[model samples]
Target: MTRELDLVVVGSLNVDLTAAVRRHPQPGETVSATALSTSAGGKGANQAVAAARLGARTALVGRVGADAHGEDLLTALRADGVETAHTLRDESESTGTALISVASSGENSIIVSAAANARLSPDDIARARPLLASARVVSVVLEVPVETVCAAARAALESGARLALNLSPVVDLPAEVLAAADPLIVNEHEAREILQRNGSQLPDGEVAHAEALRAIGARSAVVTFGARGSAVAEPGRAERVPGVPTEAVDTTGAGDAFAAAVAWRLSRGDSLPEAARWATRVGARSVQHPGAQPSYPTLQQVLDEPGLPV
Candidate 1:
């Protein structure tokens, strides 16, 4: 069948509970939050919404609990123009949730309860074969089981689509898994994790970190460096994409938005450097707002920004 989606995301979905605090409390101390709110989030959901808002035909394949949160998440994705028909509802578990606390400095601490997200099986991925076959690019995150991620990646490769994997949560993923991805995105910390796991220490700098990532199996690696911008590395070259000058209000989903924009651009046949530029713009846009999915920008919003090549 012809591709039905420009991008397909397979991973977790969560209800995010956010609080703004003056500062993070020290050990054994407590602090009061200044504001609180709830929104739909999860790396998978956020990226799917990000791609859809940026004009990609997107589909999400994952599981959520048969609860109000799940219903709300599905509705939100649909409203964002993402296809959720492949999303399954599990009655045995509640929807996943993340408790996020943001400090005045725009730094955040988060605790996630995987809930239904952790229960996703390879069967769920198998059920999404058609959708995977119909996508030009398939993205997966670490929130789901490794087997599920691998299955999705392998399927996408077999179907002649690109496989993009986000090595989030900074865990020790199997080497085979890394080898399967066409392009893998990770933050600076995650790059350190992979190097540490391989019995190596990355030098304390973006340039060094980018070099180490290429030493690993990623055909290409994109490392997001927060305020310092981001670095992109292919087999023979690496370059830093300058970040937009913006005062961040919340940094929670900035990386996810960046990854989504990069994947969207790649699906549209943009080169890695071009995609990284788009991702930087998207990341900058995300921090200007406060929440995860709520903070993502539409294609028009990104295009409206000055100096962006569109």
Candidate 2:
């Protein structure tokens, strides 16, 4: 019998190669980088690690290549206390990789090589059925194949687990999967793009974008504005959750931290607004440091941070 878990993440795992540059170059231009770093990352892995460190019993369902990067990613996930029994190894492809460039202003741009991640099929979701059944919340990110994401959504629905869909790098998805999102999470740009993709009138403001998502198909929705907070919309209510003011040293994994925190808190029975509030703080804290998984703050860390005011 699989034990109950707070969250199960069905997404991609990648090794992130990051470069620090003074500024991002314009197209056809190149800039010299000051430093380079390699880290255990990928939207799925980062969210799973953040959830685990925040005291949730989290499990990851994804595929990694049979390579050194894969080994390192698995080691990092385990060290962070995320269950990886379902993280499979594929021998055909190298691990997924993200080439990221962070500028002095703390903004970043990334290019992804979806190698092994592209190999995660619906069959993988079928194999992880039991783990999905034992989860209170199933969080799905879009770094993997869309078919696999759809399969995970169906499994979450069948298991009666709440679905938290983070629509980053947004793409067209079936309506049923869109409707399954208990709280569809998106950044400001993603929100607008998703709305536009669905043939809805483009919302003029960020808060309206959140409301429009709920109107389309999502049970509820959240549109995040970095450093300014997020807007949340549920069945009958809409609210803005303010952001935590902090100096950002790197903004890389802040959204992943936010998504993880919201999913974890929702599993603990927080309301949409309540969860978004917690997520905002977690995201704010993440940008204060460098890297993705490494920058996440534990629940106690959030509670103890001075001037956060809870």
Assess candidate 2 and give its lDDT: 0.92
| Residue-wise C-alpha lDDT for candidate 2, range 109-156, written one tens digit per residue | 999999999999999899999999999999999999999999999999
| Regions of candidate 2 where Cα sits further than 4 Å from its true position | 1-3, 307-310
In terms of lDDT, the poorest run of 10 residues in model 1 is: 205-214
Model 1 per-residue lDDT tens digits across residues 1-310: 5777899999899999999999988889999999999999999999999999999999999989999999999999999999998888999999999999999999899999999998888888888888899998999988887788888888888888888889897666677778866678989888888888888878776766776776777778888888788888787778888888989999988988998998899999998878999999989988988999999999899888888856
Native-vs-model 1 lDDT? 0.88
Off by over 4 Å in 1: none
lDDT of each: 0.88, 0.92
Q: Which pairs clash inside model 2? A: none
